[model samples]
Target: MFKKSVLLYLLLAIGLVLAACGQSDQGSEDKSKEEETTQGNEEEKASEESGSESEEANDKEEDADFVAAYKEGKDELAKAGEGEEVDYQKVIDLYNNQLQPLVAERDGNIDQQISTALEAGKNGEMDGQVVKQIFDKLTQKVFYLTIKHEFQEIDENWGKKEEVNEEIAEAKEYYEVLKETVEKRDAAYETNMVDQIDAGFSEIEKAVENDDNLGFQLGKQVVDKTLMKTFYLAAGAVPNGYATKAAKEAEEDPDKAKVEQAEGWAFYQSISEYITKYAEEDAKIIEKNFNLETDVKELDPEAVNHAFVRGLSKVALHEYEESEEYWGEDKSAITALEGALFIDMIASDIKRMQGEDAYNTLNEQAQTYLDAVKSDEKEKAMEVLEKIEGTLNSIIEKAK
Candidate 1:
């Protein structure tokens, strides 16, 4: 009887141990699956967080009310060309009904210009083709300025992720409308500006995602300054600018040169405010020389070109000055990048004025300074920045 009881207890103990072991194995499998699921979820989240210009554009809401109205007006005007009999009354009605209200809400100046252009076209005071060009270019300017306004809104609404994201989307949409002009300049100058601008937009989206205000500011400068550079190239940059074209044509065909000068003047309006902010006198000279009211034969492309170089050099120097003041911080890095971009705006002219070797040296020094700023190497950054400043001062004097 004692042996029987002992054997029975031993058999019950073995059964309990086997059941526990089976549960342990099942729990281990469950844990392994949970870890794999967590890792996969993290990876998927990372993939969604990555952004691009196209992605931002895709995320944007459909065109705004003004955008639709502007497009409709543009289409209506497109039918009016050189020597083509246009329904002037129809264009007037379209502007009054569709564009005028939106322009008034957006910008009073734009409203006046559109109204003036429409009246001039209706009265036969301006050529139909000229009127159309004015209409399109002026509207494009409004779009560009709206982008700036959107950035300001983003800054104001910082930390409100939804509002900030919406503003960014709006800005991206406006940029898309202006992209053709960027592409045209890139093709003409053989520069990769479109890529630069796209990278800037990407930086902006990433900054927004990370909730980094300084990063957003830095990205904004990249996009803003690059677009400014585009307009500068259109207006007065060497080798292929309207100023150069106008000068070349002036001697052979004054009328055609006038048209080119007018184009330069129109494009210059985009960057004139920035130039004026830094170098008022230089801005005045540029504006006067490129003024449509000024005869093409009287326009001095050389003087206009020189003024642009001087003004931009001053602007670059100011950026470096700000970088110096904000040393050892992200602002320093931001201004350093701005200084480099401003220098790059006149790179072709720099290469022409200072030999290629000299321009290369300057570029290398600028890049070194930027790196030092980013790394928080105050002394090294200051040393390189001073050298860059001195070189720019010399360039400014020569430009005079």
Candidate 2:
């Protein structure tokens, strides 16, 4: 009976051990299955993230292409406007062939970005941020292009009589306001300059009213000059010095002053001589209807060539005076001389092209200023500078 009881106990122990082993195996299998399922889910999530990134990258590329196209269109329009002659057909072609297409493409790109953002939002992705960024960039481009387009339109229609008339009227109104403003700023300000600007506005108005193309062209020059002056004044670009530092230095030291005064007189004399000679030559060229080929060896044989020569001469004189231990170089003088010379050249060419009478008138006015410079009177010389400026503007008008 004792042996039988021992055997039964052993059997029970064996059964319990088997049950524990089976439970362990089942738990291990379940843990392995869970790990495999988790890994598969992680891989799917990674693929989805990569796909979103790729879509975002594509959207950026399309947006970049649209911006580039718009910029290119703006540049082409600017180029067309800056041509020597406005080719209306070319402007039209550019708008039709390039600009319109770009506009359409840009619109499409905006729509696509918006649609993508909306779809992403619906899918519980980040919402509206992408659309906002695209809109911000597009708005900047559109604003800049719109301003450029307006200016191009003005340039394209500049030759039209109706457009010119409207421009002239607008200019006249602005001029009146400018005149009143100037008077308010400096009651003693030289009225001559203002009078000259007024005369320019009048000419533009008259030309447009008469429907005279040549006259209108001339009138445009006056309007352009007046506008430039208005812009300069509005921008506070007035010069700081009335005379060169060298001229000022002469006031402190008598000996140096004497020497500089003599040098200044010599410089003025040289400028006067050149002006007189050039004027005579220019008159002849105009009389010949600018048919004579220019001889560069001669001191500006043609009026058209005088601008650069005169500018260089003035710069050289200023540099020389400044280098004589009197003062540092006067950049303002150099800039002023260059600007004047440029205006003079443009005016001279226009006058010469217009006819002999116009050319002669410009030459005569220049001669008057040169003669005034020779007078050696400071006030008179300064006055002549103003007069020369006004006369040059007049020549530009007549030449047009």
Local distance difference test scores for all models: 0.75, 0.35
TM-score of 2: 0.24
- After superposition, which runs of candidate 2 have C-alpha atoms over 4 Å from their true positions? 1-155, 158-160, 184-188, 226-400
User: Which residue pairs in candidate 2 collide?
Assistant: none
All candidates' TM-scores?
0.78, 0.24
Candidate 1, overall lDDT?
0.75
* Regions more than 4 Å wrong, model 1: 1-65, 75-81, 101-106, 251-255
lDDT of 1 by residue, 165-258 (tens): 8888788888887898899999998888889988888888898899988888888888888888888998998868888888889889876676
Per-residue alpha-carbon lDDT of model 2 for 1-400, expressed as tens digits?
0133332332222111101001111112122223358788787677766865676466446444544544443343333224332233433344345344433332333333333322332343322222222222232323223222322333345556554444344334334433543343233323244655566557656655665544443434444433333322221111211112223453465333332222222122112222333344433332222111111122111232333233323432332233222222333232233334334423323344455565465455444533443343445545545555555545433432
lDDT at 275, model 1: 81
Q: What's every prediction's RMSD, in angstroms?
A: 24.5, 35.7
